[model samples]
Target: METAQYDITWTTPMCIMTLRYIGLVMDVYDGQKPKDKVKPEMMKTAIPNPPGFLEIAAYGYFFAGTFVGPQFSLSRFRSFVNGEYLENGEVRQSSIMVSIRRFVAGVVYCVFNQWGAVWIPDSFFNSQEFFNLPFVWKIIWNTLWFRATMYRYAMAWCITVCLFLINILWLILACF
Candidate 1:
């Protein structure tokens, strides 16, 4: 992975190696290579000296993406480290869909969450005078205020999920 940071040194050989690796990983995470094929640099052997630190960081970012992903393959990981991970037309089209969804979600979350005209439930803000004895209750109102705070965060999650689904749709479309 770290070794691949310098892969821009050449692109064609690297991309071919990447394509082969992606196919290999479809079976499982194989470490062994065929005797006839040309091997790219081994990322695991990278020496993290002063110059290699940035490359190491780059490697970490790629793996970070895998944390949220369902599939895992050593060969695929290695290929991605090289330049085989090319962007495609489906990705561009799905970006348009996601852009629209994101805009709608953002507007609903930011603006609709605040829309109100006399929504007072009466009990929401007022403390019952009957129960005068209590320990340190919140300095602020607990009922509506707390629920209202949580609503904004929930809305944000919905918007993020919309974006995530957009990307997933992009991948599915790419498969065809």
Candidate 2:
């Protein structure tokens, strides 16, 4: 029998959601206990009242974080939704220049990763030429190869963060 191969696109979002749900459950459990029994750090995130289904859904599907997350607690989500960060319900304008800078950085990272892949292809590792190299040179090649691979992830994360910042700016603008 042959094993079937599949492309699973939901894995990343599912993993992130799973962690978030687990954290919420643990926080709720902690909240049910006496204050003295909970660690101070845990208490900071503890939820005295579990959120309703709609709130949980909103948190799970939070637009800025649903795809590639810098995962945060439900409390933080609530604070954001409630506009707790705003002073006297006033929305502060985000600096356009800052967002522009972040967008430029993300583009730079993406371009660098593209060039890195072309220059230091992963296929080089499997080639006979790689094995024929001196030990020190092999190490150098491996290091460069690793860095090239990691740049792809770096580019993605940088772009995602830039998007998240833009989303926040828009939300603030819309709310005002």
Candidate 3:
């Protein structure tokens, strides 16, 4: 059987959004139950009142997490929107350094991924030359190739996290 590869653009966001919506629905359900019936940790996330359409839309398309995510609950999103993190009406400025570090790490990972891909292209895996390699050499080559592939995901997530941090900073600044 021949394996076919399809260029899927929507599936990633669709899958992420599906999970987010499911979690949101479950949280809303938990909110409808009496406080005593819900788990303590879950109670922290339960929404006693349903969010408006605009709130749901904002959370669903939240730019920082739209592509790759560190999924957060609707309650957390509300708290963020409500400025719950502010102390003395001041936004914490410490995250600027953290964002810078994450951005630098993401750039480094991207560079490594590009460099590695050029030296160890995935096409080499299916080449006849690959089949001629000794077992030990093949194992080593496969490990290197896998690491190269994984670097792409690492780079993406790191950059996504940096974007999240920057978004928070922007929101805080806008409020001041």
Best by TM-score: 2
Error of 1 at 31 (Å): 18
The C-alpha stretches of model 3 lying farther than 4 A from their native spots are 1-11, 34-45, 79-90
TM-score against native, each model: 0.30, 0.79, 0.76
Question: All models: lDDT?
Answer: 0.45, 0.79, 0.85
lDDT, residue 131, candidate 1? 39
List model 3 lDDT by residue over 63-155, tens digit each.
776787768899998887788877876668658889999999999988988888899987898999999999999999999977977887788
| Better TM-score candidate (1, 3) | 3
**Cα deviation in Å at residue 49, candidate 1?**
22
Best by lDDT: 3
Question: Which pairs of residues collide in candidate 2?
Answer: none
Winner on lDDT between 1 and 3 is 3
Q: For residues 1-176, could you state the per-residue lDDT of candidate 2 as single tens digits? A: 33242222568778878888888888889988999999999988899998999999999888567676778888899998888987899765884667677778778877887787789876788899999999999999888877866766666676666777788788768877
| RMSD of each predicted structure | 15.5, 4.1, 4.0
TM-score of 1: 0.30
In each prediction, how many residue pairs overlap at the backbone (N, C-alpha, C within less than 3 A)?
1, 0, 0
Residue-level lDDT for 26 in candidate 3: 96
What TM-score does candidate 2 get on C-alpha atoms?
0.79
